[model samples]
Target: MKVAVDQGLCCGAGQCVLVAPEVFDQQEEDGRVILLDPEPGEGHAAAVREAAATCPTGAVRLVDGD
Candidate 1:
Protein backbone atom coordinates (compact mmCIF):
# COMPACT_ATOMS: atom_id res chain seq x y z
CA MET A 1 0.00 0.00 0.00
CA LYS A 2 1.00 3.58 -0.64
CA VAL A 3 0.05 6.49 1.59
CA ALA A 4 -0.26 10.14 0.67
CA VAL A 5 -1.32 13.39 2.36
CA ASP A 6 -2.56 16.48 0.54
CA GLN A 7 -1.02 19.64 1.87
CA GLY A 8 -3.80 21.83 0.54
CA LEU A 9 -6.50 19.84 2.29
CA CYS A 10 -4.64 19.51 5.56
CA CYS A 11 -5.42 21.92 8.37
CA GLY A 12 -2.63 20.98 10.76
CA ALA A 13 -4.98 19.03 13.02
CA GLY A 14 -2.20 16.58 13.99
CA GLN A 15 -4.64 13.71 14.27
CA CYS A 16 -2.76 11.63 11.72
CA VAL A 17 0.49 12.28 13.48
CA LEU A 18 -0.96 11.23 16.80
CA VAL A 19 -2.37 8.04 15.38
CA ALA A 20 0.71 6.99 13.36
CA PRO A 21 3.80 8.70 14.57
CA GLU A 22 6.00 6.30 12.69
CA VAL A 23 4.24 6.98 9.45
CA PHE A 24 3.01 10.54 9.86
CA ASP A 25 4.15 13.79 11.41
CA GLN A 26 3.38 17.52 11.36
CA GLN A 27 5.38 20.38 9.94
CA GLU A 28 7.11 22.39 12.63
CA GLU A 29 5.62 25.74 11.72
CA ASP A 30 2.27 24.97 10.10
CA GLY A 31 1.60 21.53 11.53
CA ARG A 32 0.58 20.23 8.13
CA VAL A 33 0.64 16.50 7.63
CA ILE A 34 3.94 14.97 6.60
CA LEU A 35 4.57 11.42 5.53
CA LEU A 36 7.34 9.83 7.50
CA ASP A 37 6.97 6.62 5.61
CA PRO A 38 4.89 6.89 2.50
CA GLU A 39 5.32 3.19 1.96
CA PRO A 40 5.60 1.95 5.47
CA GLY A 41 6.23 -1.65 6.46
CA GLU A 42 3.42 -4.15 6.61
CA GLY A 43 3.33 -3.89 10.39
CA HIS A 44 2.36 -0.24 10.07
CA ALA A 45 -0.58 -0.76 7.73
CA ALA A 46 -3.10 -0.68 10.56
CA ALA A 47 -1.67 2.49 11.97
CA VAL A 48 -1.65 4.11 8.54
CA ARG A 49 -5.27 3.18 8.05
CA GLU A 50 -6.09 4.54 11.46
CA ALA A 51 -4.35 7.78 10.61
CA ALA A 52 -6.25 8.05 7.35
CA ALA A 53 -9.52 7.45 9.13
CA THR A 54 -8.75 9.82 11.97
CA CYS A 55 -7.62 12.71 9.77
CA PRO A 56 -10.31 15.34 10.29
CA THR A 57 -9.65 16.97 6.93
CA GLY A 58 -9.39 13.69 5.05
CA ALA A 59 -6.00 14.67 3.74
CA VAL A 60 -4.57 11.23 4.00
CA ARG A 61 -5.16 8.75 1.21
CA LEU A 62 -4.41 5.02 1.24
CA VAL A 63 -3.65 3.57 -2.17
CA ASP A 64 -4.33 -0.11 -2.32
CA GLY A 65 -2.16 -2.52 -4.26
CA ASP A 66 -3.93 -4.58 -6.82
Candidate 2:
Protein backbone atom coordinates (compact mmCIF):
# COMPACT_ATOMS: atom_id res chain seq x y z
CA MET A 1 0.00 0.00 0.00
CA LYS A 2 1.06 3.57 -0.61
CA VAL A 3 0.57 6.31 1.97
CA ALA A 4 0.09 10.05 1.72
CA VAL A 5 -0.59 12.77 4.26
CA ASP A 6 -1.75 16.36 3.82
CA GLN A 7 0.22 18.39 6.25
CA GLY A 8 -1.83 21.43 5.33
CA LEU A 9 -4.88 19.65 6.64
CA CYS A 10 -3.28 18.10 9.68
CA CYS A 11 -4.35 19.25 13.10
CA GLY A 12 -1.70 17.34 15.07
CA ALA A 13 -4.21 14.91 16.44
CA GLY A 14 -1.45 12.23 16.63
CA GLN A 15 -3.73 9.26 16.06
CA CYS A 16 -1.72 8.28 13.00
CA VAL A 17 1.54 8.30 14.91
CA LEU A 18 0.10 6.22 17.74
CA VAL A 19 -1.47 3.69 15.42
CA ALA A 20 1.47 3.38 13.00
CA PRO A 21 4.68 4.67 14.43
CA GLU A 22 6.67 2.68 11.90
CA VAL A 23 4.90 4.51 9.14
CA PHE A 24 4.08 7.84 10.76
CA ASP A 25 5.57 10.35 13.16
CA GLN A 26 4.95 13.80 14.64
CA GLN A 27 6.82 17.04 14.22
CA GLU A 28 8.22 17.95 17.64
CA GLU A 29 7.62 21.64 17.28
CA ASP A 30 4.22 21.83 15.61
CA GLY A 31 2.90 18.32 16.26
CA ARG A 32 2.04 17.86 12.60
CA VAL A 33 1.81 14.39 11.18
CA ILE A 34 4.80 13.06 9.30
CA LEU A 35 4.89 10.24 6.83
CA LEU A 36 7.74 7.96 7.79
CA ASP A 37 7.05 5.38 5.12
CA PRO A 38 5.41 6.40 1.91
CA GLU A 39 5.47 2.81 0.85
CA PRO A 40 5.45 0.58 3.86
CA GLY A 41 5.43 -3.19 3.52
CA GLU A 42 2.30 -5.30 3.58
CA GLY A 43 2.98 -6.18 7.21
CA HIS A 44 2.06 -2.62 8.15
CA ALA A 45 -0.96 -2.32 5.88
CA ALA A 46 -3.49 -2.91 8.62
CA ALA A 47 -1.92 -0.39 10.95
CA VAL A 48 -1.62 2.14 8.17
CA ARG A 49 -5.28 1.80 7.32
CA GLU A 50 -6.21 2.05 10.95
CA ALA A 51 -4.12 5.18 11.32
CA ALA A 52 -5.81 6.79 8.35
CA ALA A 53 -9.20 5.88 9.68
CA THR A 54 -8.41 7.32 13.05
CA CYS A 55 -7.10 10.63 11.79
CA PRO A 56 -9.32 13.34 13.25
CA THR A 57 -8.79 15.67 10.31
CA GLY A 58 -8.68 12.95 7.71
CA ALA A 59 -5.23 14.03 6.71
CA VAL A 60 -3.95 10.54 6.05
CA ARG A 61 -4.67 9.00 2.68
CA LEU A 62 -3.94 5.75 0.88
CA VAL A 63 -3.66 4.82 -2.76
CA ASP A 64 -2.11 2.32 -5.16
CA GLY A 65 -3.54 -0.95 -3.87
CA ASP A 66 -4.35 0.26 -0.38
Candidate 3:
Protein backbone atom coordinates (compact mmCIF):
# COMPACT_ATOMS: atom_id res chain seq x y z
CA MET A 1 0.00 0.00 0.00
CA LYS A 2 0.97 3.61 -0.51
CA VAL A 3 0.35 6.44 1.93
CA ALA A 4 -0.08 10.09 1.07
CA VAL A 5 -0.83 13.19 3.08
CA ASP A 6 -2.53 16.47 2.16
CA GLN A 7 -0.66 18.94 4.25
CA GLY A 8 -2.98 21.71 3.13
CA LEU A 9 -5.90 20.11 4.88
CA CYS A 10 -4.09 19.19 8.04
CA CYS A 11 -5.09 20.94 11.24
CA GLY A 12 -2.20 19.80 13.44
CA ALA A 13 -4.41 17.21 15.09
CA GLY A 14 -1.57 14.67 15.30
CA GLN A 15 -3.93 11.72 15.19
CA CYS A 16 -2.02 10.11 12.35
CA VAL A 17 1.22 10.31 14.24
CA LEU A 18 -0.42 8.83 17.29
CA VAL A 19 -1.83 5.95 15.28
CA ALA A 20 1.27 5.26 13.16
CA PRO A 21 4.41 7.06 14.22
CA GLU A 22 6.55 4.91 11.92
CA VAL A 23 4.53 5.93 8.91
CA PHE A 24 3.54 9.50 9.72
CA ASP A 25 4.79 12.52 11.60
CA GLN A 26 4.06 16.19 12.23
CA GLN A 27 5.98 19.23 11.18
CA GLU A 28 7.59 20.88 14.18
CA GLU A 29 6.66 24.41 13.17
CA ASP A 30 3.13 23.96 11.83
CA GLY A 31 2.29 20.48 13.11
CA ARG A 32 0.99 19.49 9.70
CA VAL A 33 1.03 15.88 8.65
CA ILE A 34 4.26 14.53 7.21
CA LEU A 35 4.79 11.39 5.20
CA LEU A 36 7.46 9.30 6.85
CA ASP A 37 6.88 6.25 4.68
CA PRO A 38 5.15 6.78 1.40
CA GLU A 39 5.06 3.03 0.87
CA PRO A 40 4.95 1.33 4.20
CA GLY A 41 5.36 -2.43 4.59
CA GLU A 42 2.44 -4.81 5.07
CA GLY A 43 3.03 -4.88 8.81
CA HIS A 44 2.15 -1.18 8.93
CA ALA A 45 -0.81 -1.27 6.58
CA ALA A 46 -3.35 -1.65 9.35
CA ALA A 47 -1.93 1.23 11.35
CA VAL A 48 -1.68 3.37 8.25
CA ARG A 49 -5.31 2.73 7.47
CA GLU A 50 -6.27 3.53 11.00
CA ALA A 51 -4.32 6.75 10.81
CA ALA A 52 -6.08 7.72 7.61
CA ALA A 53 -9.46 6.98 9.11
CA THR A 54 -8.67 8.76 12.34
CA CYS A 55 -7.31 11.88 10.67
CA PRO A 56 -9.67 14.71 11.59
CA THR A 57 -9.18 16.53 8.32
CA GLY A 58 -8.91 13.50 6.07
CA ALA A 59 -5.35 14.47 5.39
CA VAL A 60 -4.12 10.88 5.37
CA ARG A 61 -4.88 8.81 2.30
CA LEU A 62 -4.03 5.19 1.55
CA VAL A 63 -3.79 3.82 -1.94
CA ASP A 64 -3.85 0.10 -2.63
CA GLY A 65 -1.50 -1.76 -5.00
CA ASP A 66 1.53 0.37 -4.43
lDDT of 3 by residue, 1-66 (tens): 988889999999999999899988889999998898999999998899889889899988977644
Model 1 error, position 54 (Å): 1.1
Question: Best-fitting candidate, measured by lDDT?
Answer: 2
**What is each predicted model's overall lDDT from 0 to 1?**
0.87, 0.92, 0.89
Clashes within 3 Å, all models in order: 0, 0, 0
Return the clash pairs for model 2, or none: none
lDDT order, best first, reads: 2, 3, 1
lDDT for each residue of candidate 1 in 1-66, tens digit (9 for 90 to 100): 799889999999998888789988889999998888888988988888888888888999998640
Runs of candidate 1 exceeding 4 Å displacement: none
Model 1 scores a C-alpha lDDT of: 0.87
lDDT of 3: 0.89
**Candidate 2: misplaced stretches above 4 Å?**
none
Worst 10 residues of 1 by lDDT: 57-66
Error of 2 at 17 (Å): 0.7
Query: Which is the better candidate, 1 or 3, if ranked by TM-score?
Result: 3
